[model samples]
Target: MAHLALYRAWRPQTFQDMVGQQHIVQTLQNAIRENRLSHAYLFSGPRGTGKTTAAKVLAKAVNCERGPSQEPCNECPSCVRITAGTVMDVVEIDAASNRGVEEIRDIRDKVKYAPTEVRRKVYIIDEVHMLTTEAFNALLKTLEEPPAHVMFILATTESHKLPATIISRCQRFEFRRVPLEEQTARLREIAEQEGMNAEDPALAYIARLSDGGMRDAVSLLDQIASFAGGNVTLEQAIDATGGLPSEQFARLATAVRDGDVSAVLQEIDDMMKAGKSADKCLEQLMHYFRDMLLAQLAPDASSSSGRVADPSDLRQLAAGFPREKLFGIIDTLNRYQTEMKYAAHPQTMFEIALIKLCTASGETPSVQEGSAAGASAGGAQAGVSSGEVSKLQARLADMERKLEAALKGGGVAGGSTSGASASGGGRSSGVSQAPSKAPRVRVKLDPFVAAHDSPQSKELTAKWPQVLQRVKEERVTVHAWLVDGEPAAYADGTVLVAFRNTIHRETTERPANKAMIEGVLTSVLGKPAEMVTTMQKDWQEALASGAGASREEAAAGEELRLVPEDGTEPAREPIIEEALRLFGEELVVIKDD
Candidate 1:
């Protein structure tokens, strides 16, 4: 006999032999036991999920010579004939090839005849979704009213393509993709039965790569088994699946987390050169980050990832990435994954996504702000002697108390001074010093209203560069974001800053960033102040009626102005050349209010 595929050789002979999908099996078996089988049944699911196998099993069970048994007695002549495809009573048709009105008409004509040998005539149509509209219309009436001795089973991976009329006539059972554990266990049983020596990890990896498809998993095992001479290892499985080794993904992720763009690009180049699909590479990266996320949230649940990463290493790696960054990474990858589907050069798209991830993580305030402190504090909370953490925490508590006291008017007041200071060295000159250990009175300054008129707006406009410089001196990332925004309105103590993009607006609106900018405003204007951030669109909408054709309009309508860093317009592309190439122009628009 010729060599048979493992999926065919180990096809489930009984309902009990089926893996996963117990719900469908139980219902079919109970129907056979009760002799209440439907006239037409639709078995729909992904490939390799046992739809055809299940249909065959149901046929054998109903036609078994002994009785309508819940489990097929494969030893019976009827069962053997059906299993061997030799029974005239049980017919299997491939709708994919023979999908025409003539084929379905033939089925309709044959359904009226009584079985020659078996108890019932079973017609199994595979890929029934491929049936043309005319073919479906021809089969509809016969399927709805089949003979008492006839049964129809339709199998399709895509049930949605089947017309509602055809679907309504049959009992639809949707088979689920087998779970990882189930696939792995079944593969292990098959390996032992075939006398193959395979590691559990190898089997698990094959199961994962097969993506919950049993036939695919078994086929992969057969291929790997032949290559490894019946002894399969994890390396052999990984090589056969063309999967990036877990170590490579871990290395790439580390580079991304560390903001090593060169390392990230190099890893991607290596992956591309290895014949890995760009889409699959991104999928693997997404899965890797997903595992990292799981490890961060619930470490025990991460064992399902099946990666060989050390638990301690995984935890440490996860510690470096906060939940927010991980979420952003996954979201960006997902969006780009969709874009890559239609892209001509998928590899370039993948590289662009990686670079964006690198920069985004590097510039994120949460990541950048905590990185130095995390390193200095030692090992993300462990390397510090417990006593040191306690002392630092105590100092923080004392500072909090002092801040609360000041805010409540029992300590030093908070405000910024300007170069336009009063004589006698500014406001501190004549104030009497408080007694030691006393909670002295502190005066809160009245809130300053903003001025949207010309002079105040121009003053703010002129001083914007100074404010940004002060911001940069205090927090470089905040300054980098703030440069995209211009002063839109300045009133008593509140300055409305308009940002062309939502990212810069949101970044500047963070409480810490807001406080920083407000401090800058106070120092530049010689009083306590606040800064209100808005997107340029919203600012424009507000000003379209009130400040008609104001400085904002004049600046935006003037000759092109760059954001000064990357030479692109404010809140636009990071690099000007890319924007020029994209738009085929030398000028880029900017909202320079």
Candidate 2:
């Protein structure tokens, strides 16, 4: 006669009243109709799957006053009292609280008595696994052979913890978690009855978050109902539950697909300002990518049931990027999600993740539609495992250090191999342990033209080798390549030297080395030094060589023109190449061995 919660009020009272689990209900009903019931039953399942509810129904049906019927007459005093938990003959115990040997002993003592007013005495123990080993042993003896008038019902969320002996003596029924569709349908019915306004999308999101538990879905609905004032709105539901909006998630995927960094940053800013949880946003955005990735891979992933985001939006998102970039987005988002928990500033963390996602490059994996679950940080980067890459980089750095030390200690002859050129600190001898071969740097200018032409260039070139000697003096060695103006005529008082590269490049090409050259050059001509840089022919050779190239061979007919330097001939490499190649480009040292 007291008010009950919806879940409790709707608890099944008969086989006909059960919503799902028809198989269990029908089988139990048939057993009762035939009078072939088991003395003990073990019901195992996830919560809200109707385990204990079925047990109560069976008890009431067996004890009906009008008949030993498969249906309980709720109007009878016995049935009503049992349903309301007042019947003395029908006892329900929370095994979780009473899990010691004393409780089992008390139950054993009470099992000897006959039913006071019913055909059979029924005892239901919830969470039977909570019993201690001693308690389990104490009950094991009685359970093997109980009175014909007594029936025992044991229920548990995880049945594996039950002892083998206890499990062996009872009839076990393993209940599966209800599917999402079924749970959503059930929530809809309840919402309609309660007169609470709800959206299908909101209900579907709740059902998924419940993870196959109807009880969890109902609990979510209860929470949502309280927050929304009986009218569940999509925004309210997502905010309360920290879920992602379909539009926001869709935008995230689209930005990633397009590799649009600015757009990604804007989205991140908007979400952070909106007070959306950074970790939750990362999680849901990752989910959105997973869906897009699936659609991109599977030629025909047309349906949208299992997806958390909109499938229609995914088509445009997938079109924005090559089908192969999906995995990178997933990886970036997953990494951000994991790092968000420990981040001092979650906004910064998510923004960095967005940056990585927009810039990441690699193959896109082929994942089945609706199967992109559990894409954690370590799991997401299939092609480039960040852990492995970090480990490998660390190992390589260590190996390089060790190799340098070993070479410096001297080769097989005990002669140090670690130095020579002030510019290259390491010895020119190639390192034996490099994971990849060092690339060759080639400057192809015939020997004839390199010796003449720019006498000023020649004078500067002669000053260059002392860099190695200076290194012997433990000095800094800077190598600068003139990519701009040519050495021009060293006429009059200035002794002009010109370069074709920009000031920044000319500044860096070899400030230290250039200073050393300047010292030597001034020593040669005896005047204030004047070397200039210009970004002209930018030499085809220097441009082609990538980083830096030495100036060489300035013969008028040599024809190796490099940029807008002061020369009509091909730009040749400096005399430093032979020394670099012969001694080893990395380092050179004079040792005792």
Query: In model 1, what is the error at residue 26, expressed in angstroms?
Result: 1.6
TM-score of each: 0.62, 0.56
- What ranges in model 1 sit over 4 Å off? 1-4, 302-313, 365-593
Reference-based lDDT, each prediction: 0.73, 0.63
**Which predicted model would earn the best lDDT?**
1
lDDT of 2 by residue, 191-230 (tens): 9988999999788888777766666677788788887899
TM-score of 2: 0.56
- Lowest-scoring 10 consecutive residues by lDDT in candidate 1? 441-450
The positional error of residue 280 in candidate 1, measured at the CA in angstroms, is: 1.5
Angstrom error at residue 391, model 2 = 19
Clashes of each: 9, 42
